[model samples]
Target: MHIKKYFGRMLLLSFLTLPFIQGCAFFDNYARIWVASGQYGTDVKDLIAHWQDYNISYAGLSIENPSALLFDTKIDGRSITYEKWVPVTDENVLMTIVKWL
Candidate 1:
């Protein structure tokens, strides 16, 4: 009986989390955008405004002074690929990203 109850709970948990797990890719991008916006003192709307520019998207952000600006870009007919930035500050972040794009 205990084993059956545990299995039932596990199944319920799986069902509850399935949607989030399935949409993780989309959510992850939003999360990265949020993080990047906060780190670079930019607005989420502003960052998202440029999301479709050159097929570039916010990828990730580091939690340090010299943060790594992660972005997704298409290359050579390939799927979107993650690219890294050499450490930069808020002042030059946009310029660097624009240059990269």
Candidate 2:
């Protein structure tokens, strides 16, 4: 009876605890590269993507949303956008997307 109770408690704790270990920001850095490989390809480790997730960068420019075909970007932390031509006119955004693709 006591063994059953302890085993139940242990099972519950293990389920609850594993996610917290996985969710830790410390693991995100190590995990992000692996996740990016599937989303952006194996070369993702060589690209300058945001540490928080997969927004890529080059030189000093970064895309706001790499998941979007038409999205904004930043240079030295300042936002950069175009009317209908981001990669057409913006060299940084162009290069960023090229690398991402």
Winning candidate number (TM-score): 1
lDDT of 1: 0.51
Instruction: Give a tens-digit lDDT track for model 2, residues 1-101.
Output: 99999999999999999888876665646645334456545443343343232322232234543544433334346555434332434556556566665
Please write out the lDDT profile of model 1 over residues 22-45, one tens digit for every residue: 886755556463344454575435
lDDT of 1 at 15: 100
Candidate 1: which stretches are off by over 4 Å? 24-101
- TM-score per candidate, in order? 0.26, 0.26
- lDDT scores in order: 0.51, 0.50
Please give me the total number of clashing residue pairs in predicted model 1.
0
